[model samples]
Target: MVDTDSVTGTAKELAGKVRGAVGDLIGSDRDSVEGRARQVQGTAERAYGEGKDALRETADRVADAGADARDNAGRYYARAEESVRNAADEAYHFAEDAYDDGGRYLSEGRRAIAQQVEESPLAALLIAGAVGLGIGLLINTRR
Candidate 1:
């Protein structure tokens, strides 16, 4: 594509140069000046087009590199998120096991307390009455 444009621009420049030479040979000053101006304009335009093409190619390469970097970052972020989720799941299971063990310990303590209470009914009754009397006194004091 670039080669084609270069060749076409070169052809146009050659044609303008030929036209200017012919005008000079024929002694037409106006035609000679106009043809020369056309040749110069064509040369400047070709150079500008080549510069623009170079800038566009550079911009495309930069954009492609940016896209690749973004894709790599996304992949790394996904892996990091998965790692965090797995860690959280393991922590949750550990907490659940600890809670279950605590519940079992509390149940055993309650059973031991019940056995002690059954072996001393008279002591339990006296303790309950004392607690009730203390609550009544507290309520009366509040009033």
Candidate 2:
């Protein structure tokens, strides 16, 4: 409509102008008035068609922008999900390592205590009695 209709309307206007000029040259008042009316009508129709075409183009651009924004949002959401999963995996591995280290430390502490007790049975027995007395006192206070 923008291209074809505009061109047709322009052609009509030009033709009307030429006819009006010719009528004026020949002194035909009726033909001159008719030609001037055609020129005015053609101009109005051309403007209307051009306005419609401009509105259509604007609507298309807006739709395309909306689609592009939606696509970008989807990609960003996927990236955020992947990042969360990766962080969780890293945290799990870290916790596993810490648990293994704690187990090793506990084993070493038990062995050390056993060796000390073997080297000094009497001293270990006295220490154990003292620890038991301290625990009994704490329990009595809570009660």
RMSD (Cα, Å) for all candidates, in order, is 39.1, 39.9
Query: Which digits, one per residue and each the tens of the lDDT, describe model 2 over residues 80-124?
Result: 545544654554455455546656776898899999999999999
Q: Pick the candidate with the highest TM-score.
A: 2
Give per-residue CA lDDT, model 1, range 1-143, as digits (tens).
Answer: 35343455566667768877987899755455556655654554455445445544554555667887656655655565455456545544554555466567768988998988899988988999999999999999999
| Global CA lDDT computed for model 1 | 0.62
Cα error, residue 140 of model 1, in Å, equals 2.7
| lDDT of candidate model 2 versus the reference | 0.64
CA lDDT scores, all candidates in order: 0.62, 0.64
lDDT of 1 at 84: 46
With a 3 Å backbone cut-off (N, CA, C), the pairs that clash in candidate 2 are: none
